[model samples]
Target: MDTDADARVAAGVTALSERSTERAGDEFTRAAWLSLADPRSDEELSPFADEDRGWVGEGLRWLVVAAVSYRVAGREARASRRGVEGIAVARDLQTTRSHPAQRACLDEFVADFRVAAGMDDADAAYRTAADAYREAGDAVDDPHRLATSPLFRAAAAPIEQVARGPANGEIAVEWDDLHGSDPSDPGAFLARRATYKRQRFPSLLDRVVDAGRLAAPRGTTEYGNDSFRCPDCDSTDVNWIAGRTLCLRCSAPMARA
Candidate 1:
């Protein structure tokens, strides 16, 4: 196995998951504290309090699921030679501009990342995950929906394991599965579910990436031009938006080249 490649993949996933998880936790904590600090009586706040709390709570749950999924995927990437090879392939695709499938994956990944970042409230998070889940169902049934490269399929295998549904004899991971059960100890319940989901399905990140790629733009680049490339990733999918230049592939801010 390529230990170095595995380590790099693990580190990247760990960093992304940890940072996202921390941000969600902070948001939830801040909201909770603010509610407590509010001068309004419980009766006065009751009308809006449940709705607000529900939103934050759902976002926190999804973030927790994301963190667990990342950890599992990272471990899987390090567990076998095939996983290492997959990581290598994925890295290569990220830097190469020759393949249409590569471009599709990059665009999908960027869209997914944007949605993950925008999980500011429960409704948004729930809708995003639900949409992703529905899309996943469709993609699984239609193999030719996206012109998936063999390399992309191989690279995605480890991550895809975490997204499989119970219908496939895998552990249940849909949002409904995670939310429907109400145990006395919510933390313990979530821990159990996370453990089960880790063994079976793809991570939330994987689902989003897969779903977005399934709906990938065909025959054209969204913002990419042959004249510009991201120095960090050697990708030509760079664009200027909102007064700053960004690499859609790697989300790196770069000066125009």
Candidate 2:
């Protein structure tokens, strides 16, 4: 039987079917991350787990999706204090997302978010992703720029930073909120919450990392996606921005790349 990429990755399978356990480090990883939040069952996460180390910049995207899932479920789970299912799903997803291939160069993202999901620390994931927003941008201008995956324009728009980067990622939640007076079943709550998120953020992964690039003081020299260009330097280090091909460097409007 043929196993999908996500399942393979989850089981620690090699990237290539015939090759040894080596990193593909090519456009495939780009394709994978860009589609992780595609709302399909193709399993984009599998390929990303073994991509080249440089692609770690994409960690923000994964972190963002995981954070959203965690937050929504965590909230509902708390409201239904007796239900551990929501929390379980959140913890598993967060742990998996938190541990993309080590070569991705995403720093300690996995460590930062593991506890948050395991113990319902939603802020830890979001706050850490916020810091990464700046870091990802700065790396874009470096000699070895932070090469990100394909995504939408607003996906990387600095103005669209989803959650505000609070000084503290931790907050006190009253016990009352846990297993509140809500009358919904735990399973139903999680199902609805997950569905709502999937619909609202169809491309949650793309938005998170791409927004990180935009949120920074700089822009990204991203690859893949549609086409892009810059008017000033004519730099094509761009990606799909809303409806235009925006320049990462000068932020000037230009024709397609």
Candidate 3:
């Protein structure tokens, strides 16, 4: 995907995170604090667990979608809540599960999320993570499991749906609010939606990507280096802004090698 297309996906994911966080209230705030707080025993942190599980679980589902979207886009997309606080919230949810496989699935999701953030090609990493989540979701047998919060099933639905085609084939993303007019064409959808986001939530979008740097840091590779050359203009004058590397000469987003 081109840089602008990638930026749109990032904005859409960021919007999803922000909406979920707003609904989750203190659950997100407390989890974010815990993620940054000094190490404490599980018992010490148990007090905050009384917060609303429904909203927290919903927020977590959004995180999963964001991660899946990044993998599907296979580009430099940023998500606001998926940063440090987001992972902390996911870990807290994992601890509440007694099902071994479910916990393990969440572990794989976090690991893949980190791995995808650092890689130029995250298709395989995310695909593996999505598959693991699907398998875990399918393992639930008991009706009681469905009655209680079935995080795996709820969170894995989008991943499974989008990744249903051939293993090496292209993915068709169709999230309701996230996609634009043509849902099947993710690039077109994101690019169009980005224009709307730029005009409507301009400030919010900036804040989201800026804050997301904590989770997905753009590396310190110098611009003039052989590896950092802009693919379009071949210019070494590139700058990082809101997680995108853009060439100063042509104002095009530079793809990293």
**Cα RMSD for candidates in order:** 19.5, 18.2, 16.8
1-257 per-residue lDDT for model 2 (tens digits) = 22242342222112221122122112223323443433233443442343333232333333332333333333323223212322332334344443232211232233223322233433443344334433333323321112223221112321122221120101111112211132233222212222222232224323433333211112234743246555566666553232334444433454666
User: For residues 184-208, what per-residue lDDT tens digits would candidate 3 score against the true structure?
Assistant: 4333333332233223222322233
Q: How many backbone clashes does candidate 2 have?
A: 10
> Model 1 misses residue 82 by how many Å?
27
| Clash list (residue pairs), candidate 3 | none
- TM-score each candidate: 0.26, 0.24, 0.31
Which candidate model has the greater lDDT, 2 or 3? Answer: 3
Off by over 4 Å in 1: 1-48, 52-54, 65-222, 225-228, 238-246
Error of 3 at 9 (Å): 14
Best by lDDT: 3
Please give, for residues 135-222, the per-residue lDDT of candidate 1 as tens digits. Answer: 3332233222221333223223322323432112122233334322533333332232223333333344445444322111011233
Write down the worst ten-residue block by lDDT for model 2: 164-173
lDDT of 2: 0.30
Cα displacement (Å) at residue 16, model 1: 3.6
